[model samples]
Target: MYRLVLLVLLALPLAGCFAPRAEDTARNWRPMGANGLALGRLVALSPGVTRATWEAFAGIKGQTVVRLAAEYDPVRAAAGCPPPEAGMVRAARSFLIVDLAVTPQKSVDFIAAKAQAYSADGYFEEYDLDIGVIAALAARARPMPCADLALPGYLR
Candidate 1:
């Protein structure tokens, strides 16, 4: 399995939302536990910096990997995505609680380690994603490196 620097997201198709719901706004994202949710493939290649970013955003004290998986079934994602879209990744639709994070690189390492769960031979389930979206998020995000998170599970 392979890790991606960026992925897709989905919302009300933009355009003013047509008929917005109270829950649609980011203001009302209720907290949900991380238990029993379908775990997505963790592509941890660069855990160090990714964990740093997550810690900063999550306002936590320790290094943390912030997984952003969709509430819907990952299979429901486009049958084949090339560059993935913000609309394709549904953050507002769900929440990704911390799975585990011991050090800075712990997150990316987990992502890379979990590749098999979501990919085969190196192709990702979101491989059908569009390049534009992936490129944009890559440009926008402060991605950590694969090496930072490459330790074996025993190390943790």
Candidate 2:
């Protein structure tokens, strides 16, 4: 039971990351590490992909996730980021698979919000290089406070 509760707590933040607004599609400019705080990175789509695949890839970091988000790293993107020397790659792949399976298909706004969140800190700018591929799964259909999801009367 403790593990289950812990898992849910961990999931809440990830869950919050998937909220969306209606006008999100119109605003395409992605936010990247604004105001400073090395956290995440985003690689936008030259050709956008499906929601399922996109959700599977968002907010990538930490010991277990096993993925990297390098919006600034050109060489790494081209390299296809070969797995590390020992077992890190396997561990990352396993965690990613689990994340993909668990996250549901969310709105485009959710995806955009995630992009913004990366910018909220310094996540996007931190990554050294990530260009060319748009992303492996660099977005989450996340919600924003300024977006439609929040009610003006209650929120403000």
lDDT tens readout by residue for model 1, 1-156: 123322212333543345433212111122222332122212122111122112212324544434333222223222232333322322111112222322332222122111111222232222212223222222432122112112222211
Q: Give the number of the best model, judged by TM-score.
A: 2
True-vs-predicted CA distance for residue 3, candidate 1, Å: 35
List residue ranges in candidate 2 displaced over 4 A. 1-26, 30-79, 91-156
- The lowest-lDDT stretch of 10 consecutive residues in candidate 2 is 90-99
Clashes within 3 Å, all models in order? 34, 20
List, residue by residue over 1-156, the lDDT tens digit for candidate 2. Answer: 999999988897786654542122212223332342211223233112112222223342311111222122222222333433332121100111111111223212122212211222222211111221223333332111112111112211
